[model samples]
Target chain A: MPNQEKIRVNQLTKVFLKHKERVMALEDINLSIKDGEFICILGPSGCGKTTLLRILAGLEKSSSGEHQINNSGTDRPLQSMVFQEQGVIPWMTVEENVSLGLRMRHAPKKLINERTKTYLRKVGLTPYAKLYPKELSGGMKQRVSIARAFANDPEILLMDEPFAALDEQNKFILQEELLSIWEETKKTVIFITHSIDEAILLSDRIFLMSSQPGTIKEEVKIDLPRPRQMTQVRSDPNTAEIFLKIWKHLQTEVQESRTKNER
Target chain B: MEELKKAVEVEKEDLRRRQRSKKFKQILTISSPLFMLVIWEFLSQTAIIDPRFFPPPTTILQTLFSMSASGELFEHVRISLIRILFGFLLGVIPAITLGLIMGMYSSVRHFFSPLIMALMPIPTLAMLPIILIIFGIGEFSKMVTIAASVFFPVVINTVAGVMNIDKVYSDVAKNYGANPKDFFMKIALPGAMPVMMEGIQMGQAIALLTIVAAEMIGANSGIGYVIWMNYKAFLIAEMFVGLILISFFGYLFSLLLRGLQSKLIPWK
Candidate 1:
């Protein structure tokens, strides 16, 4: 049986009014996410993945559609987003950034401190809690962003390629860290990214999108067991098979984008 | 282990170099004023410049000490400070309040922008005659002149600062369900602070600049009054004393404001 529905997006359409010309960013986009499901939206650049995520997070209004994140009858906000670059407010210290959402909700002082400390430790940023974002390197800053998103304790996390700016080594480390955190918390996530390996590694289901007037092309389920590690992925035949299936679908879309650019 | 020791030696040398440069800068800062004073004294005493007109640094110091002892300098400084303090408050508080309103609402900005533009370019001193005629060459006109001088820059800078804040901050706050009060107190205020602080500092500077001109026009007592009255009487030494006092206080105001910035926004 399917898990409880955590998020539902129906007939979501977005159009950009570019100098009196309407550009279709997303057309009849529809998605359903289950409770605690780790879903990745994998697509090429300019494929409206970010727009989809923004709409889901309520950052932007859909031109036409119904998008709902089930609130679980809580008084708190239902979702939080981790943006790709420098989402941590530069003016706030690491601890303040992590404690922000809780503070805004007026969560008790004790709970705020406890949750902030817990996530800071999880992301290995406890020592740097007193430092500002300017003092942090890019990798460390992204870790703070992750810590902050998790610390908010939202019903769903919307991450828009949060680690896309990091180096390869940092990416692997953060991906591993994020997966471990997800395994522990089981928070439903809608992650947007262009990296195929990242989608395969972290996500339970990958929704692939085609470019230039973007729409979901296919949904590829990884069917991987929980508590998976990044190290043993190369030996898993399932990883290769899923990668190939998604690549086969994506290859043509990428080629089409390139040819259009050339023309 | 040998390589580690070599690294430690290199670090020690770097520290020593830094210390040497820091000491040199400190000496230069301390000696610069003294060097100028000494040059002025030599020029005056050796007849390179007429002592009657230029006066030696020593005579200026003597005149300042006597004036200070007789309570003349203190009275003037007190009167000047009171005028400036009141004038600064009159100008700054209203400017910030209106500027914030204008920045938050486009309609308010549209209404005020043209008026502010028209008045801002007209120099504060140029309005002195009209103001004196209206307010009768009393302390009121002087205060009004200083207030007008301070008002424009603060409003302009404050509006710019508020409008210039990145939309991302509001987006993040909105995503977290921040109410308007929390949004303003936590995000908008702090985000706009660096620029607002710049505006305040500029306001303080303009207050200082306009106070002197206002006092020079018609004032019974002030540092500016001392300078003006002494120049008229050809008490060159006392005029130099007044000029020095003005410089010292101007420098102090800036230093105090800078310290306030660091205290208020230590994140930077």
Candidate 2:
């Protein structure tokens, strides 16, 4: 039997030394993520959602905290991160970029090829396997990056607003695809985004954060059904109600952050 | 509209014909020097430009053939090539390594930048006399001079190559759990290859030029030595042959480097 708890974070804090001043980026961040859950960290820019995600991904060190991943001894849960800028290597072809994590892990060439091809097909990028990042559109590049993260078959997937650069239509389609892929893989996902609609649409739970020395202000459970359609979700009264509640909390933080930034 | 369509068709046909003609012209252009040789032979036979001083192309070819048969031309070419190879390797390897280090670490680059700036302005050829005096006009002196000629451009271009890489690539590598070796091999090396290859190309050309000049000053057996000896003996034909050989070797060397570059970095 799998452990119910996937990731546990206890009193995590991050402090940044900017010049001579010690600035806290995140303070007293504590959260427990259940297995196979989709969680979104929502906050304004500089609210330390990204900092929290980075710490979780082991890319950045926390000032003080404890984090543990429950793998049940089957394997160390693989973690993969997707960035906003679409971290596809410009020199590599789409397929090559998709297989990079596997290659890094020293996976056999045949397995890498098979997994890369499968993921490319899933992302609707099979035809673009030979195409370099420079040849792809913004949406296509993001798809490639997502496919790469998926190809790793990670236990936890961290995304820092991966689709924030895409147009609405592309974003909707990608969101649907992401949900479908997540349903099949059941990976624990920690997505950070500034979009309220995105958080409401995708997350099983939204961890709304407050600005400056960021701390989780509230956690909103999403009781919507599976295989959610964006159109239906938008039209559904419950979705709109949840979005409005999140927005009301976010608006004040946004205004305060803007004023602070200006100063 | 009909006329315009017809004109378009005609223009396309003309373009196709022009492309074919241009290809043929390029082939002819490459062989033009050889054709000039034929013309020169005929002109010399018909008594033009004093056959003694400006030898006919045939005479030069014959001299080249005789020299090769006697192993004289081969010896000179071998010596010159060995000198260039040694000098280039000595200069370029250290330059690239130092350049990469300096580029990756800004503090190191800052410390060395002023030193490089001061040293770069001194021409490689100007140090020839000092080098000869120190090293005693031997093969070492010639090799060291050639190495010096190749070093600066390689170092400068290598630093530029490393510095110009996109920061996003490095960030991506870091985010993906890449260690230092993986980051350098996968991102930094490939990213900077194009500029580094160009630097190597420049270094190669400089190496060849410096080697020849160094040979002229002190070497006992090289193309430059041949040229100098021929000139002193008033053997203008032999001197011209040496000049042609130098050009041919330089051209071949460049083509070789370009081919290697294309093969190594097909994407660039």
Q: What is the C-alpha lDDT profile of model 1 across A158-220, one tens digit per residue?
A: 999998999999999999999999888899999998889999889989999989788998898
What is the i-RMS of every prediction?
1.1, 2.1
lDDT value, candidate 1, whole model: 0.88
Q: Model 2, range A151-225, lDDT digits (tens) per residue?
A: 887778999999888999999999999999999888899999999889888999999999997999999999889
TM-score of 2: 0.81
For model 2, residues B166-208, the per-residue Cα lDDT tens digits are 8767766765656667766777778777898899999998887
Q: Which residue pairs collide, candidate 2?
A: none
User: TM-score for each prediction?
Assistant: 0.93, 0.81
Off by over 4 Å in 2: A1-3, A261-263, B1-71, B97-141, B234-241
Error of 2 at A232 (Å): 2.0
The Cα local distance difference test for each model comes to: 0.88, 0.86
Give the lDDT of residue A211 in candidate 2. 97
DockQ agreement of candidate 2 with the native complex: 0.34
